[model samples]
Target: MTESGVAAGFLTLVVVMGIGRFLYTPLLPLMLTEYGLRTEQAGFLASLNYVGYLAGAFAAGPLCHRFREFRVLVAGLLISCLTTAATGLSTDFVWVTAARLLAGIASALAFVAVSGLVLLIVARDGRENLTGLYYGGVGGGIVLTGLAALPTARIWGAGGTWILFGAVGATLSGVVLLLLQRHDEPRHSAATPRATLPWHPRFARLVIAYGLEGFGYIITGTFMVAAANATVGPTGAHLAWVVAGCAALPSAFLWSTAARRWGRLKPLVVAFFLQGAGIILPAALNGAAALFAGALLFGATFMGIVTLALSEGASYAPTARARIVGLMTGIYGIGQIVGPALAGYFSARTGTYHIAIFIASATVAAAGGLLIPDAFAHEQARERR
Candidate 1:
């Protein structure tokens, strides 16, 4: 049953995130050519999606407290599947944008609910190491969706591809629902006392660093395929996305292993630095090889950073885990909201994405520096105690 629960959660993430949330990245270039969307308009749509994500993240905590987590997950998956299909039904910009926004909201709800449920299931089974496997579902989705793009595009253009992805998401969601049907409804207990850790500078640094990550990583995630298409061609772009997905698949487990051996803070800091390099590589150098390398690096670390950062945040406020996660998610959502629009604006103004990518790299590198101080501070605090 625990294994089934984990499988259900994994499939839920694959549908909500891989198909509903991130399919946009691989489809953006096609949308530009087929639908005639400007770079800025694409950015606008991405930002709007993030806005919906922010709202959903904020709502998930309260909603889960009030209702069964499985119910919330089902509702989110349903919305995501429907909205994703809806994107294929129209060429109207307003309709497409609305679908993306709603899909984003659904993705967030599903993500939060599924993650919490999976963790609970893992804890119950005493298989904490499997946590990475649960989160790896997102990368699995990325790879599957990326691979689906080519054949889908060949058979049915951009709109057809959207419809196909929607159908796939819907099917997967149904499977997950079936797998989870045996689980009992979750019950809420009395709230625990909040941890009384000092409002240390390290905590603030973590928040800011995470927000910066949100800003830095998203630029490449959003536009890498588009940029690659322009520089190398369609094949190269597809390869880049696939490479990223492949690299991302095992990254969580690898990072988790490193964290256990070296400690979380050091591993996280190194991840930030490596991810910064990944974000800049394609922009700084020419050729398909460079782009692919960048994608690999980016994919390898981005999700790992997410896992590590959230764990760090939870450790800092163990008694208030949900609240802290929500707050950090909200901040991260804000960074996502700002990143694409900012990148699009600069791309439009300069006729290149290089400047925006450079900015993203620098911001990520600075975030790494922020973590260094936090690591040292944490060590000192521990020693003093």
Candidate 2:
């Protein structure tokens, strides 16, 4: 495949994962009455999906070294489609959960493959710019589903929505696999026999921060659409997602431009603030405007934060970009796995998502502030040297 083809593959991969993954939240109300689920139970089932994703992230490097990335990518998508479609077929909690877990694993494998493929197609300078465009597909998928699937839920119900995605995912899996560009071995290939990196102090902090973003962001991912619906009623909630998806569509360009002018930390700090403000938007004013603004703020900055922070993290050890990013991705996945559980606990205790959402809001706010201290410290060290 050409560079353009590869970029399209990455976009398709994100869209497929988006379809199989977060497509559940807006349709949760139907799942609630259709399946007899409490709030905590519903949240727990969502975590089950992330659990599989966590496992897949950790396994990506070693598995690729053992086998081949293209094969892994194709199989993962096939499994994800089957599992996601089957998820709607069973109204039972256990069966629904089992399907979700499998779907998560499949999504993770394809994601890891596509991320690695970026370097194969684009050069180092271009990687930072491409990161947002690649990941932006997640938001794009949300927009597509929000506009289309939410309406489908009212008509054919959740089963039909899931069934449609299964076909789409299966088709894309084959298409992307065939379209994958042939490239030389990745320079930073973790699968290479000689590849290795010893974790250091600065890199450790970057990893921790990235995981924190995961902890904070997953709350929005799990509940943003639900919160919007609850705040202003269902008719407008899907439109809030439209705001998010559209805002997210351009985030890659916005963040990348900022990073280019001001440097990585500056844009990342701004992103954290955007997310924190957005997360708490509902509590301040429970209206359609507030919710829509929140979704736009959250969606616009969330993935860009991941792109900038992780790209900076990888630079600290450029020789191992794929592995280091994969490791951080796994750690981030762990935070996501825990995020839903924490949200579930708070929802159970307070009988609302407010406590959980606020907890997330505070976390990103602090993370943004933490970057200030880090910048000062780095400057001081440079002066002393």
**Which candidate has the highest lDDT of all?**
1
Model 2: residues >4 Å from true position, as ranges? 124-128, 182-191, 376-385
Over the stretch 1-385, how does candidate 1's per-residue lDDT look in tens digits? 8888878877887899878878888888888988889999998888888888888888886677667578789889999999988988888999999998998889888887777677667666786667677777878889997888877887788888988888999899889989888666456644733335436777778888999999999889889888899878887798789899888888987887876676678889999999999999987888877888899999999888987887677666554445566667778888899999999999999989999999999999999999896666666447423
Clashing pairs in 1: none
* Residue lDDT tens for model 2, 130-203: 66667677777777777887788888788777877777777766666556644543533444563575476656
Candidate 1 least-lDDT 10 residues: 189-198
Candidate 1 total steric clashes: 0
User: How well does candidate 2 match the true structure in TM-score terms?
Assistant: 0.91
Question: What is the lDDT for 112 in model 2?
Answer: 74
> In candidate 2, which residue pairs get closer than 3 Å at backbone N, Cα or C atoms, i.e. clash?
1-181
CA lDDT of each candidate? 0.83, 0.74
